[model samples]
Target: MAYVITKLCLNCKDIACTQVCPVDCIYEYKGDDPSIPKEMLLIDPDECIDCNACVPECPWEAIFEESEVPDIFKDDIELNARIVGKERFVPKRNPDDPIPTPEQIAANKEKWGYKP
Candidate 1:
């Protein structure tokens, strides 16, 4: 089964998991407007190799194996598939891109009016 990224990633937006993914399956949906707060990222089920490398890399513990996903986060599995299927998913930032620090994440949250 593929891995799914959950709501815990909403404001966290840490790229650690994405950077560790052997396949470029993680994606985000920031919509057409660059000014908008980016939504959570998702794993492309079709592309993911089911490798667990990303699990330990996620600082927020947002990624989960499909079968192991908690009941509360089960919807995220479908969400990932739906977003990818609709071609609304944007590829994650390059692995070489610098990850945002805690201070930067906080500032971004404030700038985007995101509570978490």
Candidate 2:
């Protein structure tokens, strides 16, 4: 099964996962919603090789195996699948950016109303 990028990534699109993705299945969703603090990044489940390459790369702990996706973020499964053909999106993950520290990641998740 494909790995899913969840709400923990709402304000943190570090792109670390994309940097190591062998197939580049990750995408950047361009939504005009004013509440989104940053550009949203999603994994194209259909294209994901299920190689587990993107899982450890996400500092926000945003990516999870499709079956392991927590219930709080469960809606994202359909969200990821449905957005593919219906929204404005692009393959925009390409930079060797610095990975976030544990503290930074925790803070980001908190900003998005998540704590763990």
Model 2, position 105, has a per-residue lDDT of 80
Instruction: Mark the 10 consecutive residues where model 2 has the least summed lDDT.
Output: 31-40
* lDDT (tens digit, per residue) of candidate 2 on 1-116: 78888888875776777778898778775666543223557777888889998887777789889999887788878767644544444454546666778888878767766655
> If scored against the real structure, what TM-score would every candidate get?
0.68, 0.75
Runs in model 1 lying further than 4 Å from the true structure: 30-37, 85-116
lDDT of 1 by residue, 6-100 (tens): 76677667567776787778877555644323567878899999889988887656678999887776777887776555444445555565666
| Model 2 alpha-carbon drift over 4 Å, by segment | 30-38, 86-98, 111-116
Residue 115's lDDT in candidate 1: 53
lDDT at position 94, candidate 1: 55
